[model samples]
Target: MIWETLVEPFAAYGFMRRALVGCIAVSLGATPIGVFLLLRRMSLTGDAMAHAILPGAAVGYLIAGLSLTAMTVGGLIAGMAVALFSGFVSRVTPLREDASLAAFYLISLAAGVLIVSIRGSNVDLMHVLFGTVLALDDAALILLCVVASITVIAVALLFRPLVLECADPQFLRTVSGLSAVTHFTFLALAVLNLVGGFHAFGTLMIVGIMILPAAAARFWSVSVGGMIVVAAHIAVSASVAGLLFSYHHSLPSGPAIILAAGVAYALSLVIGPVGGLARQIPSRPRTQL
Candidate 1:
């Protein structure tokens, strides 16, 4: 009974299969980035950039009327521009990076809403805000797969520098001048994944895939590689659970996935052994003196 209830929906429906694949692909790309974001203390930056991509997509909606290519291109352009410009502002001005990103996040979200209102109805708006995961077409699914492939390769190539860049920026600068390169590269990859998944998962909930799984994993492991592995598993589990929940309850798909991730995080907070409520500080047993 349990197996049939869980596997039947996906086996019977092609859309369910596509949604599952899309969620998995996005999770693979988003997990490592989320780990890095958490390590760098930039968890909310993912949220900020998620909102920051809206204006660009809204512009595409304004001009092309829900054309996927148009909206995607617009989102890529806008997300990259905001990311780079905010980094520039932080370097050149007194405002910190978080402050600059937060400012642009608010502005971009408001502008995106207004622009969407100009051309799209509430229905269109909801699609952009929450996404239609169960209704992913071939183009969007293909895009997610491609983004996942590119992200895996790029992350593998950038691994060493990114680790150094995240763990110790000053030492990285002195040893190798790839600090700026790695930072911007990281931002680009992040924006790429978000933009790629925006049409399928929407901007608001996509970050949940990136951050929540990584957050849950932090309580499961200490090594970066271990956390990444655990995070990927968490992401896949959340996607599966979320799809099942939506299927059974007739709820919105995207939010259901995020909510499932939220549940995982809540569970991790309570029972995870690394840093969870179960063990606030991991301590080794005292050796005999």
Candidate 2:
């Protein structure tokens, strides 16, 4: 009975299988980046960067009418531009990094909306925002797989410098000049993941994959490697649960996945192994004699 209820849908349908594969690929690649974003205290920054890619994606839609290559390239350019510009402004001006990022993202969001309005219907815009995970074609799947491969390779190569850069940037600067390089490299990887996710989950929900799983892992693990492993598990679990929920309930897929991640995040908050609510609650100080 359990197997029929839980496993039959995926076994019966090709789309279900593809969706599962897509979500797993995304979880494996994007969740690690999410961990780093959490470590850097840049969760909101990641969100902003997610929005910052929209105008580029919208432009791609305008040019290619949803050509994966065009939109992805556009998103990459926009995301990287915003990240670099925000970093530069923080360094050169009085505006703080968060403030600069906020300003730029808002502008980008408005621009993306306006561009989409000029050429696309509400349906087209919605697809760009919400995605069609079940409808993923071969091209989309291939792109996601490629992005996952690149992300794994990049994280492995940049692990040491990135760890030093995030843990202690000032010390990294004194010890080596790769601080900026490391930072930007990580940002580029993040942008790439977001672009890949834009296909599977859309720009809005993409950040959900990146942040929620990472946040949940923090409750279960202390080490970076451990967190990555746990986060991957959480992400894969959420993706499967969300897809199942969407299928059975006839709900939208992208938001369903994010909501599933939210559920995991909520559970982590209350009962996780780390400083969860259970741990944080006082043990009712022993009564004095």
Candidate 3:
């Protein structure tokens, strides 16, 4: 009975299969980026960048009327611009990258909202904000797969420099010119994954799939590689479970997935192997001899 409930949806419905594939692609691509963001203490930066893509998507909507290709291109351009501009500003001014990102994203979010409202209906805006995972078509699936593949390959190529940059940026800067390379490359990957994620989970929720699973995985593993592996597993599991739950309960698919991830993060906070609440409780010291 449990197996039937869990397995029958994908078997019975083509949309279910497509949704699963899309979610898995996002998990594979986005969670690794999330891990690096977490290590660098830049989870909020990921969120900022996610918002930064909205104006581009809104512009694409305005130009082409919800065409995925246009929206994707717009999002990529917008996200990368924020990243580059933020980097440039930090170098030239007293403002730090985080503050620059925050300011840019706020402006972007306001601009996107205004743009979408000018020509779009509430429903259209909702779709951009929250996502439409169950409605993914062939083009969306293909885009997701391509993005995930590229992200995996790029991360593999940049892995060593990325680690060094995160661990010891001053040392990496002194030794190699690759700090900027790794930073912008990772930012590019983040944009790509977020654009793909917007298709599956929308702009609002995509960051959850990216950061939540990675954050949860932190409670389970100590190594970067292990954290990434665990994060992927957690993300996949959450996607599957969330989809099933949504099917059974008639909930919105995107929020259901994020809610599932939220649940996992909460559980990890309580009982996870690393710095969980339970683990942090100091046990009575052993009596001295």
lDDT of 3 by residue, 200-227 (tens): 8888899999999999999999889899
Q: Scored by Cα lDDT, where does model 1 land?
A: 0.89
Better-scoring candidate (TM-score), 2 or 3:
2
Considering only N, C-alpha and C atoms within 3 Å, which residue pairs clash in candidate 1? none
Clashing pairs in 3: none
State each model's CA lDDT, in order.
Answer: 0.89, 0.90, 0.91
Kindly give the stretch of ten consecutive residues in candidate 1 with the minimal lDDT sum: 280-289
For 50-144, candidate 1 gives per-residue lDDT tens digits of 89899999999999998888899999999888877876899999998888888889898899999999988999998888888888899998999
Per-residue lDDT, model 2, residue 4, is 71
Q: How many residue pairs clash in each candidate?
A: 0, 0, 0
lDDT for 32 (candidate 1): 91
Q: What is the C-alpha RMSD, rounded to one decimal, of candidate 3?
A: 2.0
Q: How far is candidate 2 from the true structure (C-alpha RMSD, Å)?
A: 2.0
TM-score of 2: 0.95
Residue runs of model 3 more than 4 Å from their true location after superposition: 283-289
